[model samples]
Target: MRTTRSYLALALAFVLVLTGQSMALARTAPGPDGQIVLCTGTGPVAVLVDDQGQPIGPSHICPDCALSLFQALAETAPEIAAPTSWLRAHPIEFTLVFHSPAPRPAVARGPPQAA
Candidate 1:
């Protein structure tokens, strides 16, 4: 009986948490021309933006996209972006090396004597 109640409580809590998150994401701010800004993007590859179209923190975008965004934002000096074409040109190569200590000579022993 206790187990059943505990499981029910856990499930209810899970549902409540999901509902709260969805509600938070569904929040929209009034946009220009009386339009409401809606959360956009599919799956985890999402970006939450403010009414001004500026991105908000704690977005759901992918890790790679977040990395690129941060790298672009941190650029202080004027420099060309790193080329990624070389990655496809060169194939990944893995090398494995094994090393073992010199083997010791086996010594012949007679039957064990009673201690």
Candidate 2:
């Protein structure tokens, strides 16, 4: 398991380096009508364009982007403990008893064995 974790960490680091290099090499240019262009999985796509076919200034994050960020955060967020009040209201009780093991019965000895 430790070896597997080390290999996984190395692989993740390599992937991140490659991704960073690729992103650094690639550049996104504006569309013909000065529309905001963003690189998508398929290709560069025009986004945040106005009715006048011009790029709109970034004022606020789009709902879809906000939702995606929220989901990412939720996935990475650490687990939270249950409320203290609730735990106090509903307490758990248990009894742990340890008993000695039973003694084994001894078998009767057989008659003297032949020489």
Candidate 3:
């Protein structure tokens, strides 16, 4: 099962590579359970959602770029008590943004909407 998930992740990475978005060396940030693995890419933050496609919390942003992760967490710390499980992670925006010179890929897979 781990291998399968790795393959899936690899394939997604490959697809990103095929596009013009320039990605740096891979880095992943899985949730406390390790099942919800977020990563660095060219786009907006990944939204945490429930099974019905409703957002349970703010999107998870990449740590290397933009603002401090600690600050982002502090702003949203009150939402840690949400119930139920997520159906799947969705990346959004598809912007090639990063702190360094490398062009990042899509940050998350969900549609673009206000937080």
Candidate 4:
């Protein structure tokens, strides 16, 4: 009877661990809106949301581009960029929002001289 109880306890513990991990994964998963927001900077920072109004994640930016963005933000808003000292420090939050699709840029026509 004691051995059975011990086995059951071990099983329960394993199940609990698995449940916790799954919950964490779910939180990180993209929602129906497919968006995630991260808070960036010290305070009162602004983040651009996508067409769906979802806050874009850092992964969307390439490493080199991200660095450039950080530098630019630092110059414009030192307080916001201060948290970027850490390699993984992301000071932006992505919020899902609704946006009308943007129209494509118009193509330029031939020069007047050619007409």
**lDDT score, candidate 2, position 90:** 72
Q: Best candidate per lDDT, number?
A: 2
Instruction: Please say which candidate is ahead in TM-score: 1 or 2.
Output: 2
Segments in model 2 whose C-alpha atoms lie over 4 Å from true places: 26-115
TM-score per candidate, in order?
A: 0.26, 0.27, 0.18, 0.28
Report RMSD (Å) for each prediction in the order shown.
24.1, 26.5, 29.9, 23.2
Worst 10 residues of 1 by lDDT: 28-37
Instruction: Give Cα-based local distance difference scores for all models.
Output: 0.63, 0.67, 0.57, 0.64
- lDDT (10s digit) by residue, model 1, range 1-115: 9999999999999999986676555454232332334555743444455667666645344423445776678758558888866644677899999999999999999887985
Instruction: Encode model 4's per-residue lDDT on 4-105: one tens digit a residue.
Output: 999999999999899667666656655344444456686555555566886754333232344577667664645544464656666998999999999999
**What TM-score does model 3 achieve against the real structure?**
0.18
List residue ranges in candidate 1 displaced over 4 A.
29-115
lDDT of candidate 3 over 1-115, digit per residue (tens): 9999999999998887764242232134333221233565875556565555555554344535545655667845545667688788787867776766678786868867887
Scored against the true structure, residue 100 in model 4 reaches a CA lDDT of 97
Regarding TM-score, does 3 or 4 come out ahead? 4
- lDDT for model 2: 0.67
- lDDT by residue (30-108, candidate 2, tens digit) is 3234466789999998666766866665434343355577667674765789866643477799999999999989989
Report lDDT (Cα) of residue 80, candidate 3: 62
